[model samples]
Target: MQLQKKSKKISAIAQNKNLSIQFSLDGFSFCITDLTTNDVNLFSEYIFEKTIASPELLLEKIMYIFANDKDLQQDFKSVSAIHQNNLATIVPNDFFDRNNLVPYLKYSVKTLATDFITYDNLSSINANTVYIPYVNINNYLFQNFGEFEYMHHASVLIDKLITKIKNSSIKTGFFVNVAPNLMDIIIIENDKLSMYNSFSYSCKEDFIYYILFTAEQLQMNPEEFQLTFLGKIESDSDLYKITYNYIRNINFIESTTCFFNEDDDFSNHSNYILLS
Candidate 1:
């Protein structure tokens, strides 16, 4: 990555910290790691009171974060950004064609001529993630960091989960990453990705409905298939309670208390994309 320093006065360490930021419709979170120590020196998130309406407004929110968050306004040896949105689709590697990006996402998500479509080749899952990223946000990062790397959040979440279960004793199960209004469901069978899909819900009914509906389509019995929960959910939450009511073998997957050198308390399941 090329370094783009915003200030000459900033120390060389400004060029040392590797920065990673994940953006969502609801908010964005970032982490900076030291080059020499490999320690996460800073980690924080800015969640909007409600989900923003447009990419333009989302860019404004990111601008506010960069303006206010001093640690983020520095140079970096490397910068990686993750775009989290529902506008993505997974195409099996065998059927994936670079020129078919627009066609791949058009049916699942609304697109426009101005939309810049890109993809991540998820070799692990033998799939390619085709989706649209926030061009304005990428431009801002280019202006600040000169060159950086990015991918759809699904690429991170799905690829990681697929690689993970393939190594474990687990064969067939349901892994769900539950966010405030969204969830990622990965159904694995015989150590292969049977299905992976994300859904948005306003109520518990909507949430379980999508999960059970997907399982029924796959002929997965809820009473038997194991369900492991991750992301911003607690056992006490209504989301957890409702899921447990329907699924018999349900539990939260255990993760370390912290990944940073400092005790910046974060759950294992919370930032599985960024922290892990």
Candidate 2:
């Protein structure tokens, strides 16, 4: 399958030895870092819409990266993938049964594929439950990359946001993570997760509509509840302008810099916190 290239710029640090990959419906992104020096050696991202119909495209891209970079091929120490597909559901811990996870998913999603899986977030013990959904391309990764850890992107973000909230005095707020054509909305109250879900939007209006609607449904006041933005968002972008116009208390969540060397370019990358 022929894949259209969206943006293909590699960072100066692209020669790093360690690698981390993130897969989304719009595309796949990988970061090369030197764990020894804690510096991000390189970062590359690609966009391919035909990935769903031809999952092999994913393998092709991975191979291309390995083939071109000899440093990445020989010095690679670890590889981890974050599945960004939206077909996931969160269930509470008390009533969660592994055996019934698939059935529970089927009732909510119309999936034709049989390879459903789950990820448990140990950090959120109070809201214990399994996150269920299928990551189609993981099979290809296992066959090619050997053993590696796979996680629902939402699970990672939720865990990170919850940890941040727990350390802060803020008792109630909403966390919004914007991905390519997708968004993850998480609600926290009193240091516990009240709601966690994903939504797809084509425009800024749709995006704001979902936020306002969710806040209204939960009886949250837009002026009172703090809303933190993360992922692919810019302060000058229309999405930010619209959100600011409607929501009184909103700000960009600071990106965690431990995973990569601090650089002006690195700070511009979206979702670095969750992707790392």
Candidate 3:
């Protein structure tokens, strides 16, 4: 398949070596990252969509490649790649035979990274020939792995980053704006415990509904737990104005920097945190 050249020139750090790519397709995102420096390279979020795969499997697949590659072990201490719609077919052939990864595949998969797994490796589908059409394509199709993969990477990298910041001279909580696709409130404090809640909704009304639901559950006013909102907002987005109005007294900063810029050392990226 022909790939479209990206025109948007986002800033990136110049390096001595070509960067390694990592792709992740778990959860609600198709994400790509440059693992060399914990930099998020590319991502696409699938709003209000769900997936059958777990996020851990996506990381394992990419990490497996990184672990197996000799050059990646040496000069490149990190891995990077983008998760796109192709993940339905991107998993490697051996992934089906690994057996270790089999338990994870609760359902039959039509596509592995390079080749198609046989009918035995897949779950029984109502239609026998459904996935036969996409047997040989290298590019991903019909899957939204990019957003979730990016989130998985971000969650892991950000945990380490929080430690780095705590160790640094900075004294502030790391504010993060997760894409709606990976809309979860997992609190990875100290990178040890995974604690967080999931919030779901499509528009501002839905967001408000979820917030109200949270408020009702906590038995506190909506304002009690400081809330912050982030994502791609057009100039006329009502949420932008509504959020500003609700949290007028509090601080709300745009979180574009966390998306990854080649020139940054991730030091300036800490200020984008949100807290109550």
Candidate 4:
């Protein structure tokens, strides 16, 4: 892998000591704040120089965060891990069987001995089964943090997007969330989740291809339905340019949830997944 930019970090003073941690294969991010007042004390985003494919490497990064930020080592009011691996699937809530999660993911992802089966129930649609391939890292989290919640990245975004659609008048819309090397495409119609899936892309063309093809397969007119973008994308980016050229009604989503501080540098669309 070619060398990329280093991580980004930001912090603020806090009135109380509450912490939330979220991380993925591409980055680790956390926010420390007072839940009562919603005052964020510290927020940081660390973009890994290379893709983390092993549990050992993931542990090293987690250890590095704890070593550098002594505050994270202390007890917090809450702690949560938003696993962001692309190996996820959404099954209808009524038909979901926890015991059969592995078979569903096996067809899409390679079986790994360390992969743990976890699921997050959507607000009104389906359950997302995520194959989190970080067994040793999860063990370390359990040993250190006693009891913490685990959520898939897609689940968080889906939850937020569902809320947005319900509150808005738009009857149909597609949300395309872009990450470093991943793209999560979600389709919503009649105020319900129609489809949700993630795809890997190596270039701008590949990224736009998936979006256009998915819309075509769904028989959704790109020019008719509104397409909202989230996650790591910028209006000036090639990914955005290519997508805009192919789709007419494309716009970036604004952050409405009070997850980040007003002073935080996290972008509305770029950091949506991490900050959600």
Best by TM-score: 1
Model 2: ten consecutive residues of lowest lDDT: 5-14
lDDT of 3 by residue, 57-142 (tens): 44444344434434334333223332322212112343444434333333544334544322222121111111212221112311
lDDT order, best first, reads: 1, 4, 2, 3
Per-model lDDT:
0.80, 0.68, 0.34, 0.75
TM-score of 4: 0.88
Q: Could you estimate the TM-score for every candidate?
A: 0.89, 0.81, 0.38, 0.88
lDDT of 2 by residue, 1-276 (tens): 445432223445433455677776567777666676766655666656543444455556656654664444544566677777667777776767766667656765556655555756545744433444334466666665677777777777777777878888888869888876788789988878888878878889999999999999999999888898887787888998999999999887765554334553334437554344
Global Cα RMSD, each model: 5.6, 3.8, 13.0, 3.1
lDDT of 4 by residue, 73-172 (tens): 7777667777777877887767778777777788888777656777777756656555554666667788888887777877888887888888988888
Which TM-score value belongs to model 1? Answer: 0.89
| Model 1 accuracy (lDDT, Cα) | 0.80
Preferred candidate (lDDT higher): 2 or 4: 4
lDDT accuracy of residue 58 in candidate 1: 86
Residue lDDT tens for model 1, 9-106: 11334346799899887878887777787666666776678878999988888887788768777778899999988889889988888986889988
Candidate 3 segments exceeding 4 Å error: 1-15, 18-78, 82-154, 157-161, 164-182, 186-194, 198-200, 215-221, 233-236, 244-276
Candidate 2 ranges with C-alpha deviation above 4 Å: 1-17, 36-39, 48-72, 126-136, 258-269, 274-276
